[model samples]
Each structure stands twice: as C-alpha cells, then as structure tokens.
Target: MKCRDGQMIPKEQRCDGIVNCADGFDETVAACAELRCQSEQFQCEYGGCVDGQAQCNGTIECIDGSDEKVELCGRRILVRPTTEPPTTAVPRCELPKQPLNGSYSVVSETNTTQTDYVLSYTCDPGFKLVGHSTVLCIEGTWPDKMPRCVQTCQLMKHPSIVYECTEEETEKPRQCNVEEIDGTIVKTSCRKPNYYSPVELPYMHCQQGMWSSGPVCTAECGTLPPESTPLVLRGSTAKFGEVPWHVGIYLKNPKSKKHMQICGGSLISNTIVLSAAHCFWNENTQRLEDVTNYAVAVGKLYRKWYHPDDEPFAQKSDISEIVVPKLYRGVELYYKNDIAIVIASRPFEYKLYVVPVCLDFNEEFSNIQLHNGNRGKAAGFGLTTGMRGSESPVLRVINLPYENYESCLNLTSPALSRYITYDDKICAGSLDGEALCRGDSGGGLAFPSSISGQRRFYLRGIASTSPPTNDQTVCNTHALTSFTSVIKFEKFIKAYWYP
Candidate 1:
C-alpha cells in the first residue's frame, strides 16, 4: 500500500501497529479504519481486525471495544471456530404479494441479520381499497391481512334527480366510489313535484361489485292528444283524441253483476285519476264502495260502457285504491273537499288517445281573471239536455265561462249557497243551457294554458254538485254548476299522486 506521503510500503506493514512510514500515515487511525475485515475476522470500531473466535467472548478483544459491544451481542450469538467462519441466527421477512387490480410498493426495507419490511397499497382508477392501505411484515410474516381492490359504482348528478343509498346512514353525498358495496340498491326520484323520471319507479342496482346507472328526471308533461283539433263552439261532440284524459268510472251492480258507467274521472297520472269522493260512496251501505267493484276505462269516445268499437283504442284498469281527504265530511260539509284520487291497479301506457292531463300544480291558473273570457272545457257521457234526458251515446264537451266567487254565490240556491266557499268551489256554466249532469259528478273541468311555449290542458276543478231546481230535475242545464277547486286540495292530491 502507498502512504499519504507518496511512499510505497509492503501491504503486510499496513495497520500492523507499526510506524513504517516516516510521516506515520500507515499507523493513523482514520486510514486504518477504512480497511474492512475478512468474513472470518472481527472488526474493531476505530482501526483493525482480529480473529473471529475472539468476538463476544465475554472480554474486550478489539482495541476500540467494538467486539464486546452490548448492541451487537444482545440479539446475536456469534459461534466461533478457527476452521470455519462465524455464524449468526436472524429473523427475516420476504416481500408480500400484490393484490388483484392493485399495486404495492416498499415503504421501507432492511437486509441486516434481523430483517423487516413495510408496504403501501394502491388500487386502480375504478377500484377502492377494502382494508388498511399500509401493512407491516415482521418475523417472515405480514402482521395484517393484505388489502383487496373492489369494484365500485359512481352516482349520477342532475338538478332534478335525487339519489338515496340503502346502506348509507348519513344524508351527505358520498364521495365517488367510497363505501359503494356490491348488491346495494340506490333509489332515485325527481326533486320537483311536477318533474318525473322518464322511467317509472327509477332505481339503480349494484351487480357483480359494480353500480348501474339510474334514470334521469324530466318535466315533460301534459302533452296534447295527437291529431286532435281544438273546438271553440259550446255543446259539441268530442273528437276521438280531443278528450284523451277523460275516463269513465264503472261500478258493478250487485244484482245484475254487470258493469255500468256510474261516474266520470280524469287521468292525472299514468297510475292516478282525479275524481269526486262521492263517486265511490255507496248510499245503501253508507260507506265507501269496495275497490275491487270499480273499474276505469280510458281513451273512450263512446258513452256505452261495453262499446265494441271503443275496445281497441281504450284501455281499462281495475281500481286498486280510492283516497279521499280526512277533512271531508261527505254531504255534511256540503261537498267541501269532495275531491278523491283513484289509483289504478297498474300504470297505463301512453298512446295517441291515452295520455295524462296536467294537474293544477302551484296554482298556476288559480286566478279567475285568466279564465274570464277564455272558456274552460268539460267532457262527459252524461245527459245532453234536461235532467231526465237520456245519457249521450257519445262523449260530449261543453265550453263554459267562469263566474266570480260573489256572482256564483248569488246564483246558487239560498239553501245551498250558505255552504259554498271561495276556497273550496268554483262556478262554471252557460245560462244558454250547456252544463254537466248526473253522470258527470266526478268529471274534470280543464282549462288550456300555455306552459313552456306549448299549449297544455290543466285540470282546475272536479265536477261536484248543482242545486236542485223547482221542477225536481236532477240536473238543470240553466243552473250554474259547482265544482271542487283542484288547487285548494293540492296537498292531498300530491300525497297520493306518486305511486
């Protein structure tokens, strides 16, 4: 080896506790400390090596006291043999396997006699971790189970749509793909009352660890009947598509077991119809009639309940439920809150002649001035003329001008006028003799309004009652007919409207 002074010396003279170089560089502690020991030797902390058998022998062998240090001898027992190298027993751990659809990296590692490892886990873009993100390996084994990557679903964002997860307890929106478990059911609905999902009863379902997308909400409603011409004349026959929302309510007679058109109703939704509560009242039993005994026929032009020609275009549904306001007291309140919603056994399919009419939501047309000169239309298969007149064989519509609250009160009979109130009733009829009669008790009185740049008919009133005349006529055409205001009972209607 060469000394610091550029003098050459025999390698055996280096670190031999000798001052061979004149400058003493060969015996310097810093220079000798850089030299490493062979596998069979024990190294001193500051300078030189010694025989392996002298290590941890309960005595200080190396001059720097390194061979007998507590840290080195505490966890290891170095077996000494002159013929063989020293041996040590150590604990070691191997690398753990990566999870599926995920990856891991070593955060820290040790290669000494006692080995240890730490790993951090990460999932792919569309996956989520199912366990701890970090893990420790000790004594040749992982301390915790390996994390797994699971498939997750993302929820849709829309202004009119609301989403709810069955598994979540909090109301806050979930972070993307977090806590979205497989087989979870997410319910979807419209945020607004008038808005609805294009898909009925829309929902999202998770399958195979993935979430399916749900339906979007829309406010497209009250579409006019296709190919139907609007008529301005009063007391005229309704076209096939003109009164598509009109429905004939039928009741089965106990003795005859035959269905007959007893009242009229209007389709407000695919599964709901707006009618008068009295339509379902059984006078003999003094209670509401059985739902199974009632049926509704939609998109019918014929007045007859069993018309052969109307079968192809009209759809019939069995009655499931009939809901009336709890505040209603039948005739004691003088037909106050007479409105009722009839739920169909199943949803009706929208067709050219079978569509729902818009309900008077938010009192959009509550102002009487809007209908001052513009007449509202009412359609029914009731009597065409006097009280005793035979029921019309075809559907008919009558256009009538609306009367103010005070004027309607004056025109009503004194016996019934006391019970009439502005909040519960509306007056509409023509003195020239066009009016709804006996069978029109539950029919809808709809007025056309422009909504979203389109003309749509909205139901404003439900045909309720008319005062009896002096001649004992059941339906007097000259009398102003009283209808239950739809807007006044909006809460009750909406409560039962959806599902």
Candidate 2:
C-alpha cells in the first residue's frame, strides 16, 4: 500500500492499530472503514478487526468499546428474570475540586450510555493560573490535573535602583522574585550612595500580587549655594564650597616625602576626576608618569597642604589609575585630545564642599552661542599674577568670555594656530592678563546650565595649554588659553566613568 506522501508500506500494515504514515493517512477513519475482516475475526464498527473469540468476553477489544456492548454480549449471558423493571446502565465521572481563589465550569458534556465532561478553570483578578485550564473526565476519573491560582508581584526594572529581598524567616538574600507572592516586602536603594531618590522610604510592598512603585535614583550633581553670586588668579578668592567640584592634583616629592599641588581637575563623579592628559605624562621620559606618585584633594581651600583652614573639609584619595586617549601624543600633536580620567583608590565622601559637577552628556553646552559673548568660569590655584609670580595658596576663579573657533584662531599665535581644531578644543579666557596661567592645567571650564529648574555648572572643557610669553615667562597670561572640549570626548569619558 502507498501512504498519502507516496511512502510504500505492507498491505496488511494499513489499519493494523498503528500509524504507517507521518500524517496518519494510513490509519484515518475513512481509510480504515474500507478494510475487510477475515472470516474468523469480528469487525469493529469504527473499523479494524479482532479474533472472533475475543469479542463479547467481558473486556473491550474495539477502539470504540463496541465489542463489549450489552447488545452484542447479551446472548452470552444467562438471564434471570427477577427484576421488577429493566434499567439502562450509565457511567459517571467524579467532579474535580475547585482551586483556591479560582473556579471551574463544565464547558461540555456528552452521554451515550455513559457521560463524558470537559472542565475549564479560571482565576480571579490579580491572580494567575499555574497549569492547563481544561481537563477531561473519563469513567469516574479526571485525566488531566487541576490548575492553581496564585497571586504575585513582578520584579521592578530600573537602571539606578537595586532591589534586595528575603523571605520572612530567612537571613539569606534571595534573588528578587519575578512574581513575588502577596505580602512580600522588598527593600530598594540607589546603586551609589552619592545618588538620591525622591521617595522618602526605600521599601516597596506587594499587595494582591501587584507591587507598589519603586524609587528612582538620581545623581545630586551641580548643587550650588543659593545666596552665592556668579563670580575669579588676577581673579578674586573663592569662598568655601564656591566651587565644590574643583579638585587639586598633587604629586609627592620622592625626596622630601611632601605633597605639592601640581595641576587642577574637576570632580565628575565620586571616584572619577576629569583632567588634562598632559598632567600625567612625563615629557622627558616620553611615557605616562607613575600612578603611585599622584593624589587628589577635594574640598580644598588652600594650596598649602598644611594650611589650617583646609583640613576641616578637605578629602584626599590616592590615584589608583590614569586613563588617556590612545591618540593623545604628549605635546607633539599640540595637545590634541588632551583629556584624562583620574580614578581614585577610594570614593570621596560627598559633602557640601565635595559635590560633583555635571558633564555635558547631551551636548547642551556645545550648542550655546559662544560668539554672543557668553562666558564660562575657570578656577585653579595657578599663578595669581604674571608668569614670574608665586602660585596662589588660595583657590580663585576668573570669568572668561568664550570665543568661537574663527576668532580664537585669529588671536592664537601663528606657530600654534594650526593645532587649534574646533572639534577637540574650545577657546576661552581673555588677553587682558586674566587668562589661565601656569599650574592651571587640567582645571575645568564650567558653563552655567539650567537643569531640573535649577542653575547648575556643567563642565565644558579642560585647560590644556596657553602660548608662552615672548619673554622668558613660561606662561603668557594675556593669551586666549586652549581647553580640551569635554563634549568632544563624551564617549571616552563615559566608558571608564560608568563602567
């Protein structure tokens, strides 16, 4: 015989109580009904055949159980006429028990001297089913298991918050439940201690299988004093907490075992400082300086390490690592891509004087009209006067007008103008002896930006280099200083800072 798919099989294999074709075409009802039974066998009503002696023997041999019907087997039994009336036998199935918080209904029923039923189950609101919804009943028994209804809460998904949970009696922390049961409580907190949430409490509750809202962690960056006015070496001295994000980069003298302020940086995160790559490069060695030789001081008011006024709020951390772009080539390329990230050995404790400044992640600061005389603030403990003057012991800030690339190029020295590209550098400061001088390298150029209905300082650039004076002075205070633009290296900064 040939199957529907053209596969060959033995003639007797068709309708032999087995499937010979992948689609079951050989055993289908229409095909099986055309089969003939041997003289010594009894044919079933639905098709197929059995031994003659196997029929009407008190057991079913046919697929439909027609071989054991009373109509066909009655002749084989001896009848005793003692009953007052003849009654037809009927088969019944036990009803399944109802699940808690759920119900079941008879979706269908059929009778042919016996009853068969189909049951469907459903859960109440805020509840979920755990198993198959329908079950079949056959001969006083259920063939399928009953389903269960359970109430639970889904796990919260947030970038800044983390959730921890434990069962009522367990001390071990468990994986947050995807479907936390009713009455479960979860504790939430920001991923970093320096971050905050609008929610007063750090707990969430699961009720009726649904979870309450969770807290969202937000970085408390760029906070400033309410009464302080926007105001700086030739610049005015800064008050305490005036520039909270500014940090002093120091190097320990190997011989004296004393730390000395070298460059300046800005705190972009609790453990990360943004600065100029040149600060960490050794020009003579033609390689990066030792990380162990560096340290960062936050909340610093005085350049002198022993200043009594600086100790109370000052926080210090050893440098664990220094990161600079691979394209940065000491001073050969004219300090192109001169950005660096300083990672602290330990996170600085955030305080009123140790907060962080915001980074222009959205390029909002870059789009501003710099040609309209918009100015930015630059702060450092750099030289207070001319190149020959002593470094300022106290921090000071100077407001410098931002200049467009074209104007900056015109003012730049002819020897250095070729290296001042618009994408990698920003031009700021004034030519009236108010520019960033020696020791101001790596300090931030901050521009005021409105964020969340508050005026906050966003770091726009890092002080890189200024043209040298025509005389013997190392720094020309009258030149427009070039700063490495923060917006240009946004991708590089985030890779290390966020990771």
Q: Which candidate is the best by lDDT?
A: 2
TM-score of 2: 0.60
The digit string of per-residue lDDT tens for model 1 on 319-347 reads: 99999887776777677888889998987
Q: What ranges in model 1 sit over 4 Å off?
A: 1-213, 217-220, 283-285, 368-371
Error of 1 at 3 (Å): 83
Q: Give the TM-score of each candidate.
A: 0.58, 0.60
Sliding window of 10 residues with minimal summed lDDT for model 1: 77-86
Residue-level lDDT of model 2, residues 78-155, one tens digit each, is 333223322754457767778899899876553321225657889887677777776655444564456888787777
- Clashing residue pair totals per candidate (backbone < 3 A): 0, 2
| TM-score of predicted structure 1 | 0.58
